[model samples]
Target: MFAPRVALASLSGESDAEWAKACARPAGAAFLGGVAVDGPTREAARELVDRDREEFLPEDPVAFVDDQLAALDDEFLRAGVNVRATGLEPLREAAAVCAAHDAILEVNAHCRQDEMCAVGAGESLLRDADRLCEQVAAAADEGAPVSVKVRAEVDGVHLPTLAKAVERAGADAVHVDAMDSRRVVRDVAEATDLFVVANNGVRGREDVFEYLAYGADAVSVGRPSRDPGRVRPVYAAVKEWFL
Candidate 1:
């Protein structure tokens, strides 16, 4: 959904507006926050903290989305928020805020955290296709562009099949964390028309070539994203390929 085709994936507690703003280099879009919305998700987020996990749990979830996105008005090329919630209402609420800023509302179906799964907010959604599609539909209904962040090689989950389902449910793009599966990106790209953004283990030009050769529209760098110098080599690779 953005040009130049590289993105910085969301890091739970650290991917706020200022962090996103500072890290916006050689990447087209920066996904901010895996924000916990609603009662169950917020409680699950708190439990994660005890285990040294990071989460964004604002006192006012919707307003936090509003303010964070407002800070990025024209400073960034594109921005998105990856969110977790046990209910559909929270998805709609966040999507409305996303629409206001012309941003993407990303449904987080990719998180593998135990706490997030127990609350039916993350990888658990992958196993429950019906629930994930419902959440995608709910968010898309709010008029913001929609993206679904997914991972490869989850037990009982088929990435290509899941990609088609989410596209039918109104997702405009699918961000795939390919993990160790080498050809998963090609399969997902072949399965649907959704913009395919491949993630994980990307370091330099060669990494970008592998994903693009397999049909990825873009590549996303996680963990090493904040250090632009570390990822600076990929920018020229992406720019040349996408241009």
Candidate 2:
């Protein structure tokens, strides 16, 4: 059997048609951006981050949040914010969108962008285990497999507890942001049984393979495919080498 390769599609600019096209490829799964929940226009939302070249979140981060929520309410109705939204409606919508597209849906609690965290999204969820579990369970009930993406935290010991909570909440997988630290990857892998995916700094097929060997059941690459020309070769390599 071929090892599965999941693609993280840039849902920011693409339409549902574009998303469906990407998902239709031989890739085993697709992950959409969670940041789209902020802005009305993808360009406007990204500007929030781009404007802050110094801190990666400019002097005013709400610019990003404004963009994110605008995008969510207008373009990506399925996008869900980690904290801004009070109820599960947005999450349910996100799950529905993934199901309609025949793709696996993921909750992004891993983004460490200062603006993102300050707003209580992304890594902020790590501090609220109970709420995270509730979100996970609600997402799972949407009838599609759900995965929660997270960053390894201080002491790293809390990962196992968090992973267990995720598993108990019915997440099909736990995507850990592996930031070029083999020790961190190893520690995380040893801690969880839920299908773990290692991401961050994964540049090529070899990196993907290394993650698998280290205990990841899957892996994700970001932005390498934004240029349509670069997408095929990477996809081909993944199919030829990993799958």
The C-alpha local distance difference test score for the whole of candidate 2 amounts to: 0.55
For model 1, residues 1-243, the per-residue Cα lDDT tens digits are 886688889998988888777767677888999998888889999999988887787799889999999999877458999998889998899999999999999999988889889989899999999999999999999999999999888989998999999999999999999999969999999999999999998888899999999999998888888787866778788877776
TM-scores of the models, in the order given = 0.97, 0.68
Best prediction by TM-score: 1
Please list the residue runs of candidate 1 whose C-alpha ends up more than 4 Å from where it truly belongs after superposition: none
Model 1 local distance difference test score: 0.89
Alpha-carbon deviation at 12 in model 1, angstroms = 1.2
Clashing pairs in 1: none
Q: What's the C-alpha lDDT at position 122 in model 2?
A: 58
Q: How close is candidate 2 to the true structure, as a TM-score?
A: 0.68
Model 1 quality (TM-score): 0.97
lDDT scores for all predictions?
0.89, 0.55
